[model samples]
Target: MRNNEMHEAGQGVLEDGHGRRFYYLRLSVTDACNFRCDYCLPEGYRARAGEAAPLSVAEAATAMRAFARLGTRKVRLSGGEPSLRADLPDIIAAARNTPGIRRVAVTSNGYKLPKVIDEWRRSGLDQLNISIDSLDAAEFARITGHDCLPRIRTGIDRALELGVQTKVNAVLLSDGATERLQQFLDWLRDTPVTLRFIELMQTGDNRDYFASNHLRGDTIERQLIESGWQLLPRAIDAGPAREYAHPDYRGSIGLITPYSRDFCQSCNRLRVSAQGKLHLCLFADAGLDLREEIRRGDVAALAERIQTLVGGKAASHYLQQGQTGATRNLSVIGG
Candidate 1:
């Protein structure tokens, strides 16, 4: 069969009968992080054994091309901080130039974004999602365990000034962070950036932090309503985040309730770690390695392996109360 014919046949269902429509590929370009955020890294976190090496730019692009050939589009490059990757613009350009890729984006902590926002825009980056939990400078520093709020603020403004679509991702912890949420919303009311509130996921080495600072999405929505913020309906894509618009605000709000209400049923994304593991679910313990196969010039075999992996995807991750398993970190999985 022709390449398009093979790709179409691989669509709708995997080889083992799992539907494969709407493939979202998240590629982690690196594992090195600058900030030691309490929610993500805590005070004295150490990398797990054999979790150091990151994929090279060439390998990342090759894997993206292979996946693109298999009907996988909508790629997002993430990392401990994707902006830290030196050749990130090159990687973005490669994915954007790849056939079958409809969307290309990046999620960064926004420290070094100001310097490269124009370069990234020129490289075909469609959207930029920066993690900014608190508007208070001190609170933001405490949350991230770093003094880079000014850089982050500048990066956000620069992205907006360059006419790049931007989204600010804030994780709502139970440390009386609602006020900070309101502060961020108030500041963003005049800007074009969309504010997204993420309910902290209970995975990775930061489980203890999540346990101590867990906040639900319902409480957040109630607080926003009580603050006279009317949530207007807005159309969003098939992502985990539920988006809302406010009448008195120019920007929008997005709630990602992965804990309160998991959207795994409609999950169309697959995460590839920097070390080359294909994770079917975010909370999965193990994954298939496609790096070696792809390097060996076995594109058809790699495609078949991806199909098998997708077919084996669970209806929902088994994240029950008091369950213990070895799950990859969100930073490594590019969430």
Candidate 2:
């Protein structure tokens, strides 16, 4: 399963049996999150078995170091809320400075950014994706079950004002969030941040939640067009989202349609859960346990194991085939 072709090109970039070279690593640092987004966390999620302990900041860096050396270029930090980790800046710095990792980014709820922005800036963090599903206070509170949208909104504004290359991530819950989505579109018209709407995905625990809240990317675009917005000439090449822009607006909009738009053909990423389980597909439970190998200092074996697992990445996830269950939820797997 070793990718001799990638090695022949230079450094050991991971390539699967399907021939996909993964340059981006979605590294989840913790399975804990501050908010209880209805679609992300199940109603009784925490009542189940406790999560495996997460990697320490240093341990996370070590994992990053290994992946970097194995030719992973970009690493994004995620968590229940990555900002909740105390050593986040250090973790970001470590990933940034890792020899082969070219950039480090973070996915957060943004409520904690006010406290970590300075350290994050100094650490050379490249991108920040704030999970903001709504700009309306009541709607936001209803979705996340937290009355912290004020803080999160302030956090997004601060990140943008501070010159952080920030992006806004919102989930499309078709039934009850149309007004909220429109409000966000109107509000973003004057802001400098790019907004990306992710189509709600279904998982085992949140199946009902997903059903009640799901929205399609195409529906959103139709609304935008009806409201006098134009689709951009081309979508941004990064990630799954098809991009769009407004003629009068400075920023753009992105659509992450994992269900309807199945981006499997262009998939080029891997994920490591906080407790050291390597996930090949976000919606697949199959994973490689790297906790012991990584903790015991066996870099060569760990890399080899990763190569073998990558070789088995399925043609596409079960979710793409209408199956919506996974061993891990989006929060645990780092979204």
Candidate 3:
């Protein structure tokens, strides 16, 4: 797109050496969450919660403004649980107000959204990705360590009733993942919410957990196909997910098989930690410290510097079993 057209579409317009434009920014507002998912947060992470404080809403807004200037068209707020932040509406408002940011989305565990769903909708939340790993109440409790399925269902229903575009993200991270996924699909037969199956990432620092529960997303997709589900392609999509829909179903199914398939050549996003560290890839160890930079310096100059460094983004993440991944887990990485 031309400069004017790019600006019109909220396409930050900055390009790398491969001609890829970074239009999406996954910004982690806070690293705190209410639930302790087995695959995400380590067992002892919550017990030792003496880490440094996260950035304030205003501080995050400043960094977002600079990111907008650098060509970020989409901003997705992610965290341990983004709704855990009291100032989430304000943060959404900041992204909605940013000139180059066309979309503002959030990823949450869906336990805290029912109370303030309308408030967040009013604050310009365009879409939501709710994490719902299982349909059975008991298993859900076992995975998330929270017996709050009723509350999560209530929040999801409330979000849908409020006319918010919402989707479900389920991580395939258990021995009976296929069975649970089939049950989850049965539960979604008449619903309109799109469900996306995410592969169990081995990036976290839990070898035992990875060994016991790491399910290959491709195997699951093939299982679904063998069971007569139609796996079709979407003309338009959001990210790495390949969307699919069954002929007789109202809702859709998608596969985010990042490990089985490589979609890095077209990857067009960056990650900003809750503390303002800029990350090029989810599996990379390198990052730019924007937390201190936000304290002082010209936003435009920072934007220019970041734009110049965009070319350094790795072509693909060399991820394997027991490989060194990002320093932090999914929560801290804003996944």
Each candidate: how many clashes? 0, 3, 1
Top candidate when judged by lDDT against the true structure: 3
What C-alpha root-mean-square deviation, in Å, does candidate 3 show against the real structure? 3.1
Candidate 1, superposed: residue stretches over 4 Å from native:
1-20, 44-52, 224-238
Error of 3 at 211 (Å): 1.7
Point to the candidate with the largest TM-score. Answer: 3
Candidate 2 lDDT by residue in tens digits, 1-335: 24633332227868888777788889998777878787877352362476577887767876776676567778889877887788888888878766667667899988777778868978888889999888878878887888888877787777787778888898887766667776876887789887999988877767666667667788887777786776655321256677777787777888887876457877878899888989888877656789887887665677777887788888777575567546446787778
RMSD to the hidden true structure, all candidates: 3.2, 3.9, 3.1
Cα displacement (angstroms), candidate 2, residue 3, comes to 22
Lowest lDDT 10-residue stretch of candidate 3: 4-13
Error of 1 at 280 (Å): 0.9
Ten-residue region with minimum lDDT total, candidate 2: 1-10
Residue-by-residue lDDT tens digits, candidate 3, 203-306? 65766777788788888778778867786754322667777777767788888876754567667788887877788888877667776667674566667667
In model 2, the clashing pairs are 32-80, 33-80, 173-213
Global lDDT scores for all candidate models: 0.75, 0.76, 0.77
Clashing pairs in 1: none
- List the candidate numbers ranked by TM-score, top first: 3, 2, 1
Q: lDDT per residue, candidate 1, 96-151, as tens digits?
A: 87776777889998888889898999999988899988888898888788788888
Worst-scoring 10-residue span by lDDT in model 1: 8-17
- TM of each candidate vs. truth: 0.88, 0.89, 0.90
Error of 3 at 119 (Å): 1.2
